[model samples]
Target: MASETDAPVDGVLIGEEATPIDLTEQAEVADASFAQVSQVQTVINHIHGDIGGASFGISGSRTKSRRTSGPVSGHEMAEARTRYERHESYEAAAQQLGRCNMVALIGTAGTGRRTAALNLLHDFVGGRREVVVELSPAYTLEKLATREYRKAHGYLLCDWPKDDVDGSIADFHLREIRRRVRDAGAYLVITATATSLPAGDQILWQPPPARDVLLAYQVAPEIAAEAAAHITPEHAMADVVALARDLAAGAPLDQALGRLESAGRRDVVAWFDAPRSRGELFEMAAMAFTAGLPEASFESLLARLESIAGIGMEKADAVSADDPMPSRRLLRVAEGSLFSLSPGRRLEFKVASHRTHVMRELYQRHGMRLWEPVIEWLHECAALRDNPSAQAEVARGVAILASVSDYSYVDSTFLTPWARGNGVMRSQATAAMAVSWLCLDETTRSEVLRTVSSWTRASAARPKFTATLAWSGELGIRFPLEAVRMLWLQIRNSEKPVRHAEIALARLFAALTEATGNALPMLDWVARQISNDKRIGRAIDPLIRAILSVLSARADGVGIPTVTAHLRTRPDSAVPLAKLWSAVLVKRPHRRDALAALYDAVCAFDERDDDDRDHVRALFAALVEALPAKERPLLAHDLRRYAISRNTDENRLEILLSLLRVFLSPAVLSLDTIGKHP
Candidate 1:
């Protein structure tokens, strides 16, 4: 039923001829990618039991139900009340909240601002029948005005959107919300950064002494004082709390603090050494790879993990029942789970730092005992086209594993197979995303670049395709010039040209031009490539088509095309423009579109400023000069005919015609042309 290329190679399916996926705008892609990385870091901070950070999400109607209905869990409220240490501004903030029925807590991150909000609410509702509900960060004054509030309840809303914190908030909107709270006999406390609020509305809160925080957690006074000595101002309250727990458990002061400094390495070691059943181990391994994925996706991955471990569902069920700890308790103890910003709940480790450690430990201690099966499972995950976000997370997990484990082993086991084996665009995307993430760390960037460079030269189509995706997406966006060079190498050296690579080059050039508002760097690169006699011969058609695509690309709100804007600012771009146009006109496929683009750019230059005429003249002269002597007259004739057909102005037409004649003169036409000059 399937072609040879579509069949499985080893465990991975080969899809070298797979169609490329459509790329979204670079800004959107960058935001999603950055959020993925940020979420990973947030999970890692959870290793220290930090609660200050929340999952990333944009406010939308889909999240409105979750935002409004969920109350702050009782455990969270109890923990906050027990551990909260009053800051210098606590009394002032409490007084404000009691008086106005609302107070905004403002401070930098990791300063216990959220905890302070919870505690303030707790004290306000003391001896009263009330619940503390955390309103969504997306909550607004309008919602406050409209929604019915339960009498005597305390509300906490952390990290309110900054855009909503404008001058109106200090005036009418704040007054209105205050009126609503007072009328309902309820108290509200909103936490935000100082920058997000008006100076008058900000009740500045600073973290209290670390010793005070440790003592509040019921640590021995002597140990608390001693541990506080090691705590820097930059240390979050969460980290201090974690340290206190260790001290209460009889850990040495130095070793307890050392664990905090060591990114949960000691904890990870302890976790593996004390682990229980096969099911729990498999679940941890699955979570290590699938954190931040939806619950259904996570369950799917868990099933796959069991299959890879040679544990049948029937056996797994028996093992689960036989285990002393319940599945729910095990989930809490082994892997910390949380709901993602997306609609469904997602799973994540309680201590995200343990994720990297788990991955590295499995590879080191288990070796092929786990790596081979994990690799095969990843290929199966990559083949699933329905859940791209899940696929991307899998790739990110691998990149994290690669960061801590043997780079060569991880590369060979996962990236190389996915890149060379699957023609699936999603699989290639997985490889590309992994490569991009690896490139983020300076320590691994060189090796990643070197490996990807070699892939561009690979004889297999899938490898080249994967490399093209990397160069076009995050890699190209971050390193435009180098991306251009590598992409050019792929295009030139291939026995036959790759259309996707050419399109990627055009897209890269267009994105850079739009972002920087200057196309000189890209234009310069194109000029150099076009100037090369041998290289240009091998890649002439794709090069010309790519140039045409870049010229035709439009930026939002810009009246002129990309090329017109470039020539207007940097007249020197005309040389490259000429060389590119000369090649385009000589190629039959792109000739008509090239002529239209040239005429449009010329007309645009004329309409804007008379000073642009010199650049236009130079562009025409060089374009004609770069063509064969026999073709120069024909190109000049075509240009004149096209301009007149578009009803060119008589004076401008005369100038263009005169310039064309001079450019087409025998001496000028005798100048060297690109390659063999057709």
Candidate 2:
């Protein structure tokens, strides 16, 4: 995030007395400065385009009239040349274009492949009297054999061999077209969306990097450094040409996204309206995640949405152009691509929220079965953790997919642990597993509950799973009553208290209250678990506090009997019982039995395990402070008698003195204050 311009620049100055400057040193200095600027400037320029550069011309500069296809006018031609030179790859592609006779250029839309092809053709023509004609995707072999097609010395075919067009049929057409052109001593250049073209040298078009975006827009160094502080180089450079053009037309950075989103939406909607197979159309829905389809097998799938919606094969070029096919127009409403090209041209989605929105709709329509292939692809990428960028992308997708509420076809083996079983997906996969848990039939749900009753193995995975269930329950999504009951039972049955168990219980308490619209079930469940779970000595205080907090907030019921019965049953429940009294006494503070329970729990201590005895002794000392001023006298007498009973044991006697001092001198009851006790 540091300013690029603020960094010290390396220098190698040449004086007039010097014979010849070392070119190597000068090159090093220039490379260092370029590297510094490239990282910072590209990010800033992407969000805020350079206003002084060329206006919106990537798509806008192209001739609008579909029927009129050829080289653009003089001014537009100049703009394409300037944008192409902003990167070395564009220059290389342009140079390569002139060398090949039958050249097939393959690339996704908006990658500047067509523009590079046109530039090469312009240079190839030079000042000679050479004829040039561009055939549309709709062109046929029969049309190419005509005098006008055969007589032309050069040719350009745009978006040829549509998705449904057979490979053999398209290849036969290409072979004959090239033969006729070679026989006539003419040249041909075809720019098609097909994955692999037949009989021609092919070039894959790579889009300019983010840094080149700043170069194409003529962004100033100082201003770019200031803007670059907040963005990173990995940010998507989609439609950079359009961005530069928009900025050149005087739009500000703040207003550009809104305008861009509106325009992008219109283009995406049009692409969905074209005719194609149901299977191919389904792939378009998946395109929201994959970013861009690769060219190696573009014919096997749909290309850019624009390529299909905007271009169609000539009736002759398409084998089934007239045959009736199933309609795929139901998905016309789903629009926009969250994924964009990285510097390596690999697909990545920058925003998590956009991914959630797209996946939500896709699931709502076709369900999780539709996501099997996408999930498999994500799993494959996730295993490459050595690449931190890829790991982060996979993590984001995992988070979005985890939020899926529907459980149809979701199972245990769905998200297998990868990276040598390190359990990287454990946390993210917990939510999805919660959904699967909710889907079980009553008998199976109960049997599954009995399986996890122990608190030993997979302890980490259990708490997260329990928390996720409580989380979903609070959202008003229905889980079986038996499932909730068994969860509460498992918490009660736990031999060793789980970390974050209190938080998990609170969420479950909230979920139960929301699910039934009543507080009695939650209160009853909490009261029963306190008495039934004998291992509650450690987790009791937190569990009671969680119960009290929820009960006070809702204040929906007055079931003191159920609470008192559970507390009274546990003779050693002073710590938790005292907390229960503290909450209940807010309404009825004069409850004598609640005070009696505290006194008995204090006097009944047997001092067997030193840790348990010390913990209980501290609980009783704390409870003395919570009692009313008048009630303290009775607690004082009980503490004094208990001190005499433990006089023979040094540790118990010391603990007793600490408790008595708490009642006799309330301000000095703290552990630090007790340390200075006689």
Please name the candidate that would achieve the greatest lDDT relative to the true structure.
Answer: 1
Instruction: Give RMSD (Å) of candidate 1 vs. truth.
Output: 22.1
Task: Quote model 1's TM-score.
Answer: 0.49
What value of lDDT does candidate 1 attain over all alpha carbons? 0.63
Pairs clashing within candidate 2: 55-245, 56-245, 138-314
Candidate 1 residue lDDT tens string, 267-304: 66776777457776667677777777777668878787
lDDT of 2 by residue, 546-614 (tens): 444433321122323222222233323434444444443333323333334343444345556444455
Cα-based TM-score, every candidate: 0.49, 0.28
TM-score of 2: 0.28
Q: Would you give me the overall lDDT of model 2?
A: 0.41
